[model samples]
Target: MPSVVKWSHYALLAGFSAVLPVAAYAQTEVEAEAEPEAATTVTDERVVLEADIVYENSADNTIIAEGNVEALHQGRVLRADRLIYDRTTERARASGNVIITEADGSQQFAEEVDVGPDLTDGYAIGYSARLPGDATVAAKSAIRRSDGINALEHVVYTACPLCEEDTTPTWSIRARRAVLDEESQMISYRDAVIEIGGVPVFYLPYLSHPDPNSERRSGLLMPNAGLSSTLGAFYKQPYYWAVSDHSDITISPMVMQNVNPLLGVDFRKRFYSGAVKFETSFTHEADFDSDGETFGEETFRGHLYGNGLFAISPEWKWGFGVETQTDDLYDRRYDISGQGDKRGLYSNQPRRLLSQVFVTGQGDSYYTDAALLNFQGLRGEDDAARLPLVSPLAYADKYWDLGAYGFASVTASTAILTREVGADSHRASLGGDWNTMKILPGGFTFEPFAELRGDYYMLDEDVSGKDSVARAVGNTGAKLAYPMVRPGTNVDLMLEPAVMAAWGFSNVNDPAIPVEDSLLYEFDESSLFEANGFGNFDLYEGDGKVSAGLTARALWKNGTEVSTTVGRRWRSRADPAFDVASNLDGKSSDWLASASLKMGKKLELSSRVRLDEKDLSLSRFDMRAATSFDWFRAVGQYYKIDERISPAGTSDEGIFLRGEIQFTDRYSVVFGQLRDISRNVNTRQEIGIAYTDDCSRFELLYNRSELRDRTLGPTESFQVRFSLLSLGNFGSDSFE
Candidate 1:
């Protein structure tokens, strides 16, 4: 006769009796000692069964269970309305709503199943499985081989959710036959069809990919196709290679109908301490004229960019960056630097790409950096030969505690630059500053500071009558502040009056000391209290100055705050070393005013203005405001600068507005525009509509730009993007 058991037998009761030791009983029955039995008398380690109703049919050496039958074998559970087990053959058959749950928590459902001893090998009809990654597979018939191979026929697979209202998924794949290879974590599909919203969209003869549970694998990524006015029709196909656990690479080939194909490769590797990345692209294409016409010459155009950083110790690190291009217009002509109008008033159009290798160190009280830098000019007007290359630039700063109420700091920097324009120079400078503060009676505070700096330069082109020059400067200043604070139940207010007097003495100006680093000077509230307004060693304030300002701040209990500051500077005499365009060139500098307001977490506003003290006309003005609600957000920015203060000798005034409004839970519209107020034209504008859900997102966008360049002209285009959760993104051009 055979035995019957419940599913719990395999999990909790299979070896329960064996686990209890006989040695414990020997201690209490020493006088009745007996010889131990042979090991062959032990129990078999096969499946133990239990059920609500069980019967043994000795005629065939079989065990049959009916009415809530359950069985367990090798960490797997089987349940059915009726089950039969042949003990001699170690085989089982189940019928009527059969379910098998593996030790890994995966479940298989079938109306009928035939499984071997360990449940690893089985054949089932009406088979269905729920696997990891929220995936499900159903088939009319399934075969599970002992070698960990699963085969299914007429199968449907999907990861999307199923609701009672609609059984059709957002996306799914149907196949005539599929095989899952557990060892390689891959699934192969034959005669597969992809369906979206229950409608067939595409078909493939054969396809194979890593299972959804895989984190990394080599495969073809999503492809992109687009139409461009400059390039005609283009397509990009990208392939990703998972080189190793800590490294990967992607190679994308771009094909254009009218131009040569471009190949781009990106590589990345990570170590325990740092990471490195490199990207490069190349093409052999004909050059284009200013009017977007292809010319005679076929040129090799490419760009290489790379960066890496590693930690040498707890406080020291080293890194290098590479930025080189075959030609400046190559990127713009190919539409590679992302879509937008990059020539806006405050866009900081990157005319120069800098490459550098540096090592840096920082501690509690000191910091240091040393680097070698090279620059490549990308603009037609910039002469690459005139740009200086710094072989080595080293800087260090350290601070020392001067007991309870004072501190001292020293800074040193040196650089050697070379250029073809005969402006090569080498300079070294050191500076030391000390300050002490005291709190007087009546809520008054006073701080006095002093600084001494010395610089020595060697010039290759001595057009100013000297090949070498040395200069030293000394400054002393004192700051006084009086604060009044008033506290109320709902708000707190503070008002502070601050004043500073500073005196400077330095060597006479030497024009040969070329102004390289401090060419753009700005008089703003951030620099109002500095002893020397200049930020570099080449320029130093020649005389004395007095700076006065008033600051007010208010904070409310509702998490709202407001702050304002107004300041001005008065010099003893106008310094000729300072450029006339700099607001600090006169005895009385521009009036600086700044204010900010914040209302809770949703709104913020800030503005800064530089006014010509004589007529109160604005020399520079910048304002920004942002607000957000439950379903909407808005941001606005305005910037205006006088032509006299512009290094390029051009005035810039613009306003940028952006907003997003959500009409429903899953739909939203976003719009933005950049308008040149000075020219009364729109530089760029974009509008997009998007739909987003928990598992997918779709967006359609229209973009327009009016930026004109040598190789690139104004552009208008439309783009569409669709993203699926756990899948990749697909992008295409709708119009151009």
Candidate 2:
């Protein structure tokens, strides 16, 4: 038999339908949202209870619920095997498989729990919780205070994935006591131990971190340790400062056993329309001479780098870049820049650094820019006094549609260059070009183009002419091409043969006009049809020339592609001013050929070569190939330049090889080597082993470089990196 007894002042139960009156304790359902600290309080909200059996004791003012008991209050749900409600005290006690789910989908489970009337303040035994960010916490006991603070004892927390077959997590944190402050969104632990694969690896007396839901906060980031042959043992500890919602800064100080310490800082800020960032570092240390010997006195060494951009409107923008270092060997010795395997790091070395400020504007038909440029030379052979400083360089270009059959473009530029050893000059130039294409009979295409340009120069000193000179030049050319296509069952083939002839009239090359640009030249298939082979206006091709090329392409239905090109140029006469390496010094230039083949996504190969027409010998050759399989990937590159064909007047050859193999789902190996064939020496070599899983990653790398730059000599380094999910990374390196 079931009996319903209602208290005079409180309605503890509602919507009950088991052998009793169901309407006596009815009240309005609450309509309120859940909050992080606690659920919203609604005056009219009623506690709805359901169970297999219920008994009300009138004298004790208590209600007992048994067998799959459930209670809903203020959009929160509670479930247990048995529940007891005290009408006098306005409290609830649940035992046996107790579970509570909040409106935000967060869940808590325990064997037993005691809660106040609101369900926000509670105490539980054998407690576990699952929150956002894949975070889980389990503890022996948990207590929730009215101020929204959760205190737990003997707690273990982890974000790692757990498999039923293997209950051990990849990484976990064990703490004797932990406190979670909902108001501050932070978790603090005391006497904590970090374990990996059930083995304790690190311990801390006190530790605190932002909750997983926090985006940014002020704290100490992970530290780094390393060893260098030049700097000896090194360590860096960084602290992050969250100044405001729109700005932050990081300060890192590095300590070295053999050298002075270094301090680095990075600042970043966001604006309504754009963002800016700056990073800089400084050190006070004794400088090293060319013989790898340190000086008696200490000096300041530093680098400053920054960049920023903002939009005036949708089509107009402005930006500037800065890259300045105190000395040439500072970056190489300290490993300040080019820390990764980049092409520029290996091929170009740190020979130059550039700083520039510029503004740019773009419209539908025109573009313009103005800039000031400065360069710092970092090579032992370079003369810093002779380097030019370019100020107030301006350029603009506009395009116009010439009716339906042609288009015309106008370009203008001006520059002022100042140098210590060479003549200072201010120059301005304007040029216009027009082109039109027509399709004739027999499927042949014909195109005619004309260009005119004028230049005015003012010089502080003259070598071959007067102080000021004006010259005007023009060129007219025509191009003709015929295409043939053949469609087959499995492949489609296309062949196109093209010819271009142009007559140019320009002022003879003036020795007084320094070759500030266009100092390096290379003739390839892509430049075979250009009106001017020179990259800049300082050098003009001059006179009459004809170029012819043939292109062939084949495409298969299975996604294979092949393309080839062959081209050559014939000059009216050999020019004495052109160097022999340019290939343009002869009546008939060297043959330029290139080919590429791609077999879907598995393999790709490309090669380009320049051959001497007289002897049919290779003058220049470059080849690259890449292939990949399910478990392995390989890449190879080779380049060779004959002494007669190289601009440096020396034979240049090199080879680069890189490969990676994955032995298992969690382990991989990578290796690479760069060798200078002409010098018969290895420039750089690297090998690394890595392990990765859902929650953590680890890598060990060994690298060697045989570069010889003044005081900076060959070096070898070993590095170790460990990354744990949500906890940042730890890195260490040793160099010799």
Candidate 3:
């Protein structure tokens, strides 16, 4: 049987307060940590008092309890060496090691306390309180009134832990007089002085903040200040408005020394089933170069980005995203980021952004998706007419379980692509596939699969040929693999040899149907044995081919692993649809090899390479490495491509590396670099030093960037940021 229980039931029993105080304290701690709604009124439950001696004087209507007195009511508890209650005045007082723990888990410790019969109002000497999240308040003395206000003298507040040897905390706030308003759950200090490293830094007449138990309250947030080569000295102050329980907005206005002021706004709202968020910024200024030199005509420049997702049903949902800008260099010049990081928003390249609306649904054995997509180019050389807009791109797939026999599945896809200056096209495709797997003797596996697909295309203009085009594609294949495992005391080894032979219709590539999604096809180890390597309806691998691969892996007992795979494909006839640089143009494809190594989680290295089959020369390679040392951690990636068969000036070689060197427990240095090896230029470089303590953090950063856009050319910046606990935080967009 299952039983339900609550700790309050146990708290109602006699003499149980001492045994359950710890449990009750834990419950309140969790509630405080979550910062739930504040309880305004005390519970009316009867107070259960336990003590060694209890006496009542009817004549004076006074009750006295001594010798380890304890009073419990719900989760709240009061403990002291002695307690006195005046029935006539409805007041209760305690002395000698008095401790009062509220229902919200806040604790107060004092030598003596006097209050009403209900203990709601009190006066205490040597008072100190511990709030949630390491925040504390101490005072020489305090007075509490029935109005739920506390007035304290000689108050000290801090969220940092104190060291016994040093005594001083990382940071502290000292005030001559402090007022705590329980009704508003706020603390206000008068004649306060801020101290850092035990040295007075700033003085304030008045300061107020929530009692660490409230969040999302409306107030002026922290300010961001920086100096940039483009914008010069800039400072932004942001104010947050808690419009309602379900919505909020932040308005940030930035003033710059070199240009006109800019305003940034962010709004968010939550619904029962979903949420929406948007951010935008606007500025009016003349065109400016990287040197902050103004030119051309003055104009309004800004950018708007937004995303939203909502649920329609249990198995269906829809979402939309949008990104737009008046010019190419606005975001970079203003240091804006966090765009294209939402659902339905896709950014394929560094300077290109995609806005989309999509609907998706899934069932036990079926899936479907439909989307409408648009593109925005942020590159200086981008031609808007050449961009593509795809509407009603849809796909659906369903499969059935065949148990003993071969399984079967059906898939359908359709797309409509339109461009301002290029041809408009529409394509629909339907395919059926059947496959099955069998385990044979000696740990051998064999599989057979067959697929037939038909695609119809309609073009508004000529596409190599004229008008509509239709093609029927079919492929049948059989794959065989033998995998073996050898377990040893020190290492475990595994090897697998796989081969596939597929016969399909040749010369099925129709020139009248243009390729959209399969323009950059590259055969690699991951697709070594696949019958069809192309991903779109227009281009399908329809020639007979044989592919083979060998994979080997070793795992050591000390959490080390190494793996390698090598594969190649042989085609009966050359496929003209693939370019030479793709490694799949000739009768024999390039040798595709990949290797990986992992020395536990702190280190990893992986590489993939393609070698020309004719000369056995390196064609292209991408390598990545990551490692963590005692004082440093770094990750690096490098890639190079052969220039012989690539587009003019497009063959590329580059490396990007970034990491942090932890020199101490509280300090570290971070750096990153992106170098264009072929061009002998550093595209981006950054270095920063960071420091953190229990109550504060400080950072200093420097960055340099060199880009192709004339308006966004070489620039450098240095930034500084610092934050303190309970005093809000301040930061800006990263240079990267």
Candidate 4:
């Protein structure tokens, strides 16, 4: 017999329900948050009561409700089979199937409940609470104080659910008494025991956890422990401090049996328009190799990384990134993997880290980016003095669509580069292009394009090129293509034949100019017809050339697709700017061939290769394949190049393989390998096993790396991680 007043569920339970997190993963917060203030707050809200059978004694100022009794206050609801209220004392008592539903959707059950003055002091017998994230807390009796404190007798807490046939939970904490402090917002347990598989394994006289409402409270985070050959047995613990509602910081200390302790700090904050984060770590120790052999004088070694971005206006923004290290081998030796992140900044490579400050702007048909970048090389032979500092590398582009006349685009760019031990240079350039395409009656397409560019440069006297130089260049070209299609009931096939011709004037590619950015170049079918295959402004093609290519695509009703392209370029006058290893140096460029196949989301294969014009032998090759099935999935990659053609001017070949297999719904295994085929060495290998379910996860992994840089040699490592849903994660790792 339930009849309730009109209400909003969220509004009613807003007060107490807001503290659900304090009760769910309540065991982890005790050390993090400060003691709550004793001050009390008052809300202007009233309680509503309803029941099927109601009786009142006016003389005694009392009311009684039987059968489906209900009381609602500020979204916290209490339901019982019988309830009695004393108006004079402002007290209430309820019995039989009592339930208390909190504002945040948590629920408590009891056989008897009693309320004290102003309905603020509530206590129950036979108490059990179901918190968010499927967590549960049970006790023989419990008391809820209006001052935000809770006390319980004979308590049991667990996040794992019990099996239908097995009454015991997978893990649980049992205590003789538990109290949640109103001031500290922490839970303290007396005579507590941790149980696994229904068997008690550990005991403590006293234990505590903190729980803060509406804000992240300070606390101890998950810790790491592991045994390693290099660092010996080690343990790393971190403490979190919630500086304010918008910012926080974490301090971690790593102690090892062999090496000196290391200290690290991480801070993060947010503002109205953006956010920023920084992490830094420091340690004092002599240099050591992978085998834990120490050398050199001991000193302070550390690293710092940071990133931030803010909006200047709706169309403009500014940001900065910082990634610096005191030494080259500190990260690999200490396992500090990620350097940092800076938005809008490009990373140089894995061997080097790049930091930059940048400003960017964007609008319809226009875009621009400018950055000041500094490079830090991680390799042993890298010299800081040789690294360049790029100041104000900027580019801007604007495009216009001219109906019937064609599309036109204008671009401007500038760069200033300086190095401690190398040549310094500055450059400015402006360019424009216009093009239009027309489709003829026979499904043949024709496109004509024109381009012009000019550049002014200033260089250091030490450079071979020139102290200053100026150059202007232009090219005009047209492309022709015809498509032939064959459409069938079950399949579709299309073939396109294309040809391009272009003439260039004003050759500006001078050896004296010093190659600044176009040191790395590769020609593929995608750029086979481009008048200037060089990716940067420092080089240009200034002669007549013709390119021809054929493209084929097939689609099947079964959802399979395949595409292929084959092309080559013939230059009337070979560009001297290209090196012999670049394949584009000769009048007739190497044949470029590429193909791709995708099969209904389950399989994919792609390959691109360059063939020598003399014998059609493979000059360069890159291939990749991936496949997925119900039980297993795998991906493979292969790359090869002549040493002379590579960016490092060294022949290289490599292969990488990774795969995962699911043997059961809850168990899986993962494996990976990266090998340098040319050097006949294994760079890395990984093997791991994992178990997962709705509420928990566990993993164990083995990793091996053979990279030998400086004093660091090959090593093998083992790591394990475990987590409970809604709670926290903890892990340990070690190397030998």
Q: What lDDT does candidate 3 reach at residue 732?
A: 52
All candidates: TM-score:
0.84, 0.85, 0.85, 0.85
lDDT for each of the candidates? 0.74, 0.73, 0.76, 0.76
Better of 1 and 3 by TM-score: 3
lDDT of 3 at 238: 82
lDDT of 3 by residue, 1-736 (tens): 0000111111112112322332223223334435544311212333566779776667886677789877776676788888766656766567788776767776667777666533346577777766555666677877766786767778777777665686787777788887766676566778998787789977878766544444456666666877888889988988888898999999999999898899999999999988998899998888888878889888888988888989999999898888888887787878789644654734455778778898989999999999998888887678888788999789999999999987999999999999888777899999999999999988899999999999888886554455788888989998999999999999999999999999999888877677787766676888888898665576788788999999999999999999999999999899888778656787888899999999965899999999888898888899999988867788999999888556553678999999888889989898899999988878898899977788777778888887657666788878776677767565753322
Backbone collision count in every prediction? 5, 0, 3, 16
Q: Candidate 2 on 127-236: residue-level lDDT in tens?
A: 77655445566778777677867677898877666667977887888889877676775667799898988899889898776555555777667778877667778899
For model 2, the local distance difference test gives: 0.73
- Give lDDT tens digits, candidate 1, residues 543-621: 8899999999999998899999999999998877777556778798888999999995499999999887888888889
Q: C-alpha displacement of 617 in model 1, angstroms?
A: 2.5
Q: What is the lDDT of residue 172 in candidate 1?
A: 68
Candidate 3, which segments miss by more than 4 Å at Cα? 1-88, 93-107, 130-135, 140-143, 150-154, 175-194, 200-211, 340-342, 345-347, 462-465, 557-559, 628-630, 645-648, 723-728, 732-736
